[model samples]
Target: MSTMAPACGAQQPGNIPTPFDWWPFVAAPIIGGALVYVWTNGIPIINGIVGASGAALGFSTLTGGAAGAASIATLVLYYVLKADGCIRSVPKGANICFSGIVNDTTDENSTAVDILAPFAMGPAGVFDVVVKSTYWHYVTDDSFWVYCDDAGAAMLPCLVKSETACGGHIGSLVGVTVGAIGGVILGYLAAAAVGIAIGCTATGFFYLLCLIIAFIIAAIVAAVVAYAGAVIGGAAGEGIAAAANANDPVVKAWKGLSPGDIVTVQGNWVTDDSLGNNEIFYTTSINRTGNVGSPGPYTTAQADDAIPSDDCNSNSNPPPPR
Candidate 1:
């Protein structure tokens, strides 16, 4: 027997067409998850672009979170992570150890000691001289300071308390931005899908009601997802930073540190981005090599003389750049 052709307006068995295919919505969460993954794991250029864009568009903790649960996270990241950058960076703490001669020491506003040692920045000679004179230097255009490179400085065996301090902040920023964006997308899509399905069964009045309900639900979902994403990003960023600092040997910032001392020192190696293009080792530990009094603090006259002179006649190993 021949089968009768189905009518145009009639629904065929097992051939019902959905007004809207929900499959496309699946990409929302997938793309978002991918962003979070890439950001937390430190995917290079792409993460940077996405993060900056998100911040500009009010989609990140760096800007959007003004007065609610989101704001809480923003404040926490800012104070705790030292999120001082226009684009936030989370500084990771670490420890390091090494032996070197005290080239110069300054206790001006903050106590600090400059050492002349074989730093990973290459055969350690003079940082300023080397950057200007040596063409084969490890210094690159990305150097945090004009004359010094934070990355190379962080690599020095005895320099920083946190080895990841150099570029570590980028990871946190990326994580927060990506996570926030992803969360909003995932939450909105999921909510929209549910809302549409619920609303699809109604006529005009009911549909309008559904639309309102859907919008409200979507807004709530998006906010929650965004908040959760930010928190997760901050946590992940911290973990990554901790992993980097895990094996480094701990040391303290030096106090009463003086010039001409044979010493081993350690501290937080950080770029002073606020003031000038320079790095500082906020010494937390100090060891006078050999006898306890062998490398004692410099005499007042000697210390004054060691102070960098405009004539460039000072004994500073890597003199301040002109």
Candidate 2:
């Protein structure tokens, strides 16, 4: 048997493959992915996706309680700052520290920062820049700096009676946006995993992708929440060392507060009770406690603080007598 070439005129009935158009191939995944994202963002299906994702990730780490706590924590911090500007503001009672020269030292490994300034006639008082943010493990020397009326002042620590100030607000706001974008990517992956397991179609897959994107938005929102938790937690964590400024009028006026630090000086017990009237008994405390955040105003013994009954407790402020 022999194969013969067909004549040009009789190229004959042979079928030819059509040229492949790049548009459909290129656009399908994109369009499909986009549609999947958008469509999955709507009602019913979106909830199902999250519920499934939560289930897959395990409810232990990502629980409704955690999210709710994050939200409530953010709102509480908002109000705490709102309720009393003092909680957010530095001690204005004494601003001009005679300490013309601000001397600073840092712990290179841990980056613990200390500032020494003359407080009135008292010796140069060395204070932590972040009395409240002590628990924060990443504080660098650059976390905060001193601002003097005259940076060129003489070497002696003048009457340093200045209050601490919050330094990371502006930087934190910028970081939140970057965190949001990164969160979106994480959410996409989380949602996609759940979406695909449910037998998502190509188009449906992209729509689901959008849902996870929303989750990233949500996570960023949660981070926004954590920001407050951080603030509250930070403020609630540590307090002025009882030994630090026992005689500094500036420190006493501020009631031993550091920048971003909020504490109530009530009957010797300091409380970072965002909602409690820790300040009500401020004048009564002969020996005021320092910054307290995590466990907050109410410790385990003080169940009343958690629910805030008629009064505070022995460990903390007891809401005055009815």
Best candidate per TM-score, number? Answer: 1
Q: Write down the lDDT that model 2 would get.
A: 0.29
- Local distance difference test, each candidate: 0.35, 0.29
Residues 98-151, candidate 1: write the lDDT tens digits.
333343433222111111100111111111111112111112212332332221
User: Candidate 2's residue-wise lDDT over 1-322, tens digit each?
Assistant: 1122111111213332223445446545754554354444522434554565554433322232233333433333333332122244321221111100012321111112222100111112322221111111111111121221122211111122222212122222333334433333344444445444555454764755554543444444445544443443332222232233346454454334332222222222122222211111112221223323332222212221322221223223211222
User: Any runs in candidate 2 off by more than 4 Å, and if so which?
Assistant: 1-165, 168-174, 197-249, 252-322
For candidate 2, the TM-score is: 0.24
Model 2 is weakest, by summed lDDT over 10 consecutive residues, at 93-102
> In model 1, which regions exceed 4 Å deviation?
1-178, 186-224, 249-322
Per-candidate TM equals: 0.30, 0.24
Query: Residue 60 CA error for candidate 2 (Å)?
Result: 24
